[model samples]
Target: MSQTTIALTYDNLVNRIVPGPQSLSYFVPLVVLPIAFSIPPWIASKQTLCAVALPIISASLVHAWTVMGGIDVISFDMLLHSYHLLLFNDPRRHFRRILAKTATAEKTRTPKVGSRDGKDESTTPQYIEQPYPAKWSGRLPWIGTLLISMRFVDWKIGSPSHDSKQPDRNPTAPSHLRFILTAILRTLSGYVVLDLTSAWTQQDPYFKTFGVSVDSPLPQYALSGLLPPRLIRCTIMALQVWASVGQQFQLPCTLPVALHWMGYLPDAWSPHLWPTFFGSFRATFTTPNLGAVRNFWGRYWHQTLRYYCSGSGVWLANLMRLPRRSQSRYLLISATTFFFSGIVHIGLVPPEPIFALKSANQIRWLILVFFWLQPVGFAFETAVSVVLHHIGTPRLIYTILNILWFTAWCCFVLPFLGEAGRNLGYWRVWPVPVSLWQGITLGKWLAWV
Candidate 1:
């Protein structure tokens, strides 16, 4: 492998930064925008729309710096660009002979299936198989649904006489109006959870209705004496768990219906019988167990990058000549997935650009430790399983211990990231319908908080 090096300089770092030009600091961090969104300013001020723009711009720049390097920026090694993940889908071939044959077949006016020199030949190739879901009738609707989702239209054009094996939506909505109404209610409920959580993070005295402060040492934090940090820290942990439930169950997964009602289309992202823009979360984070650590991340977790983190290893291992059957290879690939998880989570942590720590922020580093080290803990539990099974431990005992192991493991790691970045005093605008959240129950709820 070839190594390259480059020298760093102040010019690119906004030169004279050694002494730090005073006015440049102010200008560099700030952004100003003026807009007229085809609406009268007297009816709704431009400031209302602009409220979300600044923080969004700041977050985008900072997150881009962490994920994609340019200028003096550096992204992590585990980073996988959206298109880079598609490289694996392109097809993998080892033998040069097969590669040449496949290339030649694609170049010519040829049928996908034919004969070459009395031998059965296929453009499909001996090594890699074509994507199955694209060809599966049962799953083909998803592609149409995704395309429709962009425009916010329902997939009413193609009606399948039979639904593929998929569950029906609970609290079945018979009409589009009812579906949208339910989505609005769910969205409001989610915002309430988020608002209460934000208040809790700030340790606002007004958060008393939640009863989190009443039972714990949290009251001491804003009080006169030295605050027990654990009270708030632990409180953050509870807040994160609560927030996850809100996030998973909330209108986020169902709001596409509302968009349809508002003149956008709802894509049939869901199957025919259970049509949805995004599906249910019931299976994603269900009752936890030790063995479920594998299932939780593997089957339950939705793939933002289409399972690239886990499946990319099969491609990488082939390229690296790692034996497929070796336990060591599997463990290495599994740990590498955790590295990918660390990369994604670290991007979510507040960059704290204003802080600009010389040693870098310890909080983010600690939070990353929780993600990067999770596979090791999981690996430990896997070893425990092997030993227990080898010793012929009873299935009942194994199941009980597995649940305890998963619970203890998550409790140990969940708090680090939970308290680190969000505990800061910066207020954020959560995406919610303010019109709904500002009325009736929401008004009372906000007052309570």
Candidate 2:
């Protein structure tokens, strides 16, 4: 065979032998669900899906509450756009691929000192020398480990080569801009539809509550109350945008930075302006009790679905129509996706005081619960697999593990934390009514409403 053909064959062989870096990077996070399942029965008894689901469900309810209160549709648009941007902009993948290539190069460059140089440097028997520098240990720093692991995976998976011979091309513009614009337009349209639908649906209730005629404009009492609704809606949208952005980028993964920003933003603005902006935006979106609930649901559904669909490679591949065979592949992929979801949740963590508030406290608790549950849950799964003969229900097992893990954490772990429990509240409030709006949108439009 020609040199080129031989090289190509070798490359293909190497690619087939090595797993993708993206896949390997996911291993750390994906183990969380299995860890949850591995918990002891006594601990498992304390876990209930409702504990995990309720806070999330409540948060969704509050998001709708704010929307119904009257936040501008644009605010929601901006928030979603930010999230999409962060999701696609992760640089870790590229960084890993680079490291992997460098390693491969270094390995190939090992020196045969005596033979190559035409000098006998050593009289002793020839032995393979270590490729790494003597001054440096083979052990990598934690961060270095992550980067190197990522690179190894990338190279093995046939990532594009970065050799100098490959001429650089002008980088392509991000497709995210188009997605952002589309999301904005879609969100705006949905907002309009929501308003119109609410108007018609709310006619009877408005008449009954305010003792006013349905054919005419809102009565004075209702008009007076409208401003608060609008303000609440804007607040919800802003929070959703902020939370979603943080989650997508894994910004909150740096806990200290996230806390600083959360505390800083609210304090930086003029108190009056903050409330006014929030109120006006909320009014624009049309917030009220029920409307707020609907908006909360909408944002919840949006975040949850987005996290599940795109946050992990496995889920993204499946959602985007990539093929997978065998139950193990599916389990592996789902675990990876779930791990990413946890990272997103970590990004959403709030400061101590903010977490102490009732709603935020619940979310904070949920986050902590999941954090501890990840490893323990996986260990539990390994133990169970040893005894169980069937492995046909990996997905079901994962789900059960999550449910049990959260339940145990909430009941046994949380109560012991004392004041730590106080840290469970939300920094932002979303009204419960948004859930209704979300349901209507999904049922009728077959899309996130």
Candidate 3:
């Protein structure tokens, strides 16, 4: 050890994360306050509204981040809105722009008011007002607007709907019964995935082990001079991270839709508004190719953060006067997006002595490096795939080779993520309310027997 003594403890780290009970109050307002204020500007129907609204929103967001701890999900979410607001500067893009009134066939445009002489006295545009807004239809009260504006991830125009194959060009709104059923199923699936992963994690010695310093041995990751063990450990680490992140994003994402069903919020608030939210994360397995890695990040992953993460890069690229859709611009956006992702996640790392980290900066460095390497890997994967195709590799053999290469790539880089995650106490939190796996393993199930 480098004789640099850092004064920190495990309990200090744990204390920094606000407990679940205390977090709800902070969480609600962190999400709601911004949307509440945003509605007026949204109603004003001015894109410039975000200009005035964003600074205030950004201040509150920064204040919340400073005060809060361990509520990464919504915290990152609010920041995305702030970035979108700052960069896009369009209130309509941030929130769904609904009509003041629902339009019937007659009220689709301006309506004519006739005097007793049957001549039009006044003709003013009228929109239909509805109890519930349809999928493609518009018209909602201010309250309905508030509900719709609160959403962070699903894009009004580009987002995929209930059927991933179908874009929003012809949207289909599921029936209330079907929508609720889907929400319930998704909620249950998320819970089971989380609970199972938590149970396995609690049993895994990887989470139990920690090093005294960054240089100290971390047996969980096979820090010793060993290859096979390191590969095994890294592979397991990747799977655990994948499962944990999937459920974490899935659980919170389903809540708004479920509430929509319960509160009878609005048809505009229905799954038709965001079908992808119901299944935001797609299955990871795909035919191994250049698109495999791209698809994993772009399609299979939960894209809640994609909008603002990429938007920050887009803003920067534009500021640099890069040509639109140029290779350099694409690379810059990709790098910036991953870099922002790293910055967002770095918030999870507390002061040192949390885990193996000697100083918080050590973990921070690892976090940034881990994310920064992603674009490098993506570019390399694309180049290699092209070379393989040019060399006349058989499709089946090429795919198999790509799978191995990707798995090996994951094994190489995922240890950085595993290390950062551990230092941040990621594996410590058990999000599930009740522990069925604990009950089973501990024989608490005997009571039911």
Candidate 4:
């Protein structure tokens, strides 16, 4: 009879059980803030009002969440270590050993203590550093080691590197004076231009319908007051632009693995850069209200359509009205892509509410389905075009349908689903006008939160 045997060595165990760099990299993007708010004025000009503003705000919020989450993780690790020590009756140790080894290595690499002129003093005895006392050692458990490994991977993949020996300083700010002056000028210019344009444009009949009275000086002054806040906002915006540019443009110095994994492969990634450039351009030139409906449709729905139907040949076949013999193959491919897209949406949900409630999964599914169905519906309508099509849908009927849809979904269906559904759309949690009013009335409460 053959006997089963198990053999384990320290290195083999470590390799098998210990977390690696890749684990860290995967977590970093989830925790670290993306280069938001850093869009240059030229790029910001390309985005619609909502797109331009929302991303920057969201980035800052994510950064805050990451910082808080890190603190909580650290505190919990400490608690776990304390619990382990109490339960096992084996006082946690081994941190000093690691530190002593690290210290010894550093000493060998560089001159230590009082060694003058970069020369070793042969007169004095060299002492081997001892590990920290067993009782006081802050050794992390195996799980903590894995957590640290994952954090390291994330930092390695996503963190931008700078020369550690060099003093870190803001490259954008030459001095405190320059920073203040720049902020003031940007605020003033943005405000003056906005006010002047509002005054000129308000003379149109459209302004009256929109409740914007150009003749009222009080309203104009109130609007102009929003400019100063932009100065503070610009600092964050500048940082975002710098980070994005560094990440996208300065690929030579970035980690080779990250570039390879992202499919950069020499120059294939340059095409990806065009989106940022085009988005910037679009944000700048596109007027909000003139052809507003068409602009919004193109910017939002068209991109959604293109994104969903990008890989599969079904969209093209459908467009050309071609009937292929392999209907099953097309259906299978479409279904798989749709399912993958749903998974991608779920994956994109921010980490805070990773559970059932507040999960981004539902929104992702809705958005994906909307993109797929909207185009198909439109195509059907186009195929069945009629002479009276221009006036086919009444404005009041459309307005009622929109109200009914919002009420059925946002106010009713979502809350009934689960905690996730209720918390999912934070953006729509409060009416914008009401929120602003509350902010004005309860300034401290608004600021605290």
Candidate 5:
């Protein structure tokens, strides 16, 4: 294989920078968000708070999409952070309500010791302070709850169903030293995986199709032949994009946990807060054969954005006055959530490449269609499963069929997503300081940025 020459330039280095220009000014609203929401409800009505905060959130998102230039994922982060601020409206009310419910459930489940029939008969609020002390009066508790609300993905305040599996939110958090050590290992592993994937992706000409104009025909690369070599190449491209994005998502989950361990971040976070952000995709692969798609997105995928993304759907449903648990309501919520998710993901598309391309609209639509189809795919799986079951299909046959269907579906949609990502310079930039893959492939071990 011929090696692609590595070129270093100031422009390339700027693209790799963590924060874009004027990032500090961009973050001023984010830093102020918690404080704004933390103001005592008695002092300021929720309406007042929303009036004060919504415009800033809107402006931040506008700024991120239009102006933010460095590291593409920052735009995605800014959008999610905005969702978080909106969803959690008031941190004190939100966290207090959740903690109270948790305590109530714990009391109901365990009961006070010696209470008959699992009943807590005490006049006292039993198990109310299980996670932390009730008498722990200080600014620390308030600070912790606010920080936790910021990171909490499970028990999303505004979500419709609230049935998504809640991974342990407040695990026995590790110490600062342990957090740092674990973060180091996690970071190094992620860096290595990304570097190796980048090296592999560098060899694929399919990924190099960056400037296809609207007037020009879309290249039929994947469809050129349905042979094993081409098929494998497309599959590898999908996996490469998958692993790269997963590493980017997983790497950030470590930071909040580390800060929590350092006592800089107060407790009250999500399962993603645990160092175990990476899980085997097969862990959620069992049962309801049609659930492969759902399991892939809901279970195995990093859900850092789910709470806020799904919350938008819930908000829309409430606006329409849909009855909770109704089928139409569920479908509406799911569709809206998926639609919003697609729009937010446009942030991942680097504007630089799109601007250069004559067919920027094509890339935008590809991203939108990819995300908007998620709910449709889930619905289709369900519909097909029902039909197959009605025909008395054997369980084993159905399972095989389900897996094949999912594989074929992936083969159909992943290329569009993968190509958009590649065009946006997803795997092109080298992230790690040193590269073993580069040494093997490019004959050098140093990264340009």
Candidate 6:
């Protein structure tokens, strides 16, 4: 669905991922490291301490979880083969023959016992192609990234707290300060929206009743027959989308702004970071785009997880020899990427205690089903878009249709998703920023008056 991928520099350490006997150990560091580094800067007071402390712990655990779990490396070929063998006792005996042929060709092309250049080639083993980060020129980008990351950390550790003095209004700071302040307030509002959503369905009785897995093979979405469940699903999904804007922008984005104003975050990371993380929520929340599934996902919802997920699809599509632009290729890519995403979502459950997210095995699979179900819907959307575009429909009509389509899809799927997410304790997960909202709202009302 969302073809975004974050560039990871490492490869997988294993053929498959499963809970280990000491898998519980993965949870240990997330808790220990945060508490270990719990010191806040001198600027932090009682009210603002948790705000500063929480992001550090979150970014640390998410980073650590990626490294320790081999979340960065996913071999779709090997993964698919493993699943096939486990589920159906099929080892894909065909790939073995292809591999054998490939080995023979390489051997035949190389120096042999009686070949002319055999001795020379064998004597001098040339490094034909080196992997990333091995060459002199290759290190420049990474060097730049390193410098930026250091600057980011420096700013984060020294950023101004909630109780700290504010920047000068137009009379005190530079003109650009206005933009930064606006963003901070905006993202803070987003977090407020998220808090509201969490409060709505925090106890999810139906989700608790469903317990470990789906009650039937199919979901019992129409709780009060059809209308009531759909309406509730619609409302929650709207709130969820609203909250996502806040969660993504409010914390990760605003903290940097506070730092930048306090002379911590550099100009380099600030400008681009806010739009990518914070403004993404707007892409989903705004009119004409909200229910447009393809754009909403491709543009809005897909900021962080694309680079990893899409590689699997592109690689697999190549193997399948599915040509680009064909409906078959589109469907195959969507299916593969979404399924891998299901795997990734399962991995997202920090191998820790079940605190915010549902980490139990059976519940994890149900959560994964939320991801796994996406491709079919996306594929359907792709087909409809293609047909409508070919008939030369007006762009406005095309968009309206897509919006309706998107709304219907959300109504169908979000009931299942809302339940799963709420079950994971996503309800009221983050602390509410009461002062931020109150201040912003008061300023707005005063300006209006």
Model 1 misplacement above 4 A: 1-79, 91-189, 204-289, 320-329, 349-361, 392-396, 422-449
Consecutive 10-residue window with the lowest summed lDDT within model 3: 161-170
Per-candidate Cα lDDT values, in order, are: 0.41, 0.32, 0.54, 0.30, 0.57, 0.44
Residue 42 shift from truth in candidate 2, angstroms: 46
TM-score of each: 0.49, 0.23, 0.63, 0.25, 0.69, 0.50
Candidate 6, residues 89-178, lDDT tens digits: the string is 211111110000112234336554543222423332221211123343543443234222311221121114311211111122222455
lDDT of 4 by residue, 341-377 (tens): 4333333233333222323445445435533443333
In angstroms, how far off is 87's CA in candidate 1? 3.7
Can you tell me which runs of candidate 4 are displaced by over 4 Å? 1-309, 314-344, 350-368, 384-421, 425-439, 445-449
Taking all chains together, the TM-score of candidate 3 against the true structure is: 0.63
Question: Which regions of candidate 5 deviate over 4 angstroms?
Answer: 1-25, 60-91, 97-200, 209-230, 247-279, 321-326, 354-361, 427-449
TM-score: model 6 vs. ground truth: 0.50
Model 2 residue runs over 4 Å out of place are 1-171, 174-239, 242-323, 326-328, 343-362, 365-449
On lDDT, the leading prediction is 5
- Residue-level lDDT of model 2, residues 1-449, one tens digit each, is 01122233433332221111222222332233223223323344323422442344334433632433321222222232222222322222222221211122234454535342254433322222122122223422312332222112212221233223122211221132333454455455545444334433233232123222223343344444554432332333333443344223322123332343345532111121111111122321232111222232223223323333333454355456655554454444445544544444433333212223334335445655543444344445445544442544354454454344334433333222222322322211222334345466554432223
lDDT of 1 by residue, 1-449 (tens): 01212244543233211112223222222222112122223444434434543444344444545432221111222224211222342211110100011333454545533232234433433222122132346233433332222211321211131112112232343344555456567655655666655545544432212213322454554543454444444455555554454345434544555565454752222221143334333432233334546545555444344234554565577688887667676677777777666665554333332222222246557556877877777678677767776787775676667555655566666655543433321222232334333455346433333
**Considering lDDT, which of the candidate structures 2 and 4 is the better prediction for this target?**
2
Score residue 2 of candidate 2 by CA lDDT: 10
Q: Total clashing residue pairs per candidate?
A: 5, 75, 4, 18, 0, 7
Is candidate 1 or 5 superior in lDDT? 5
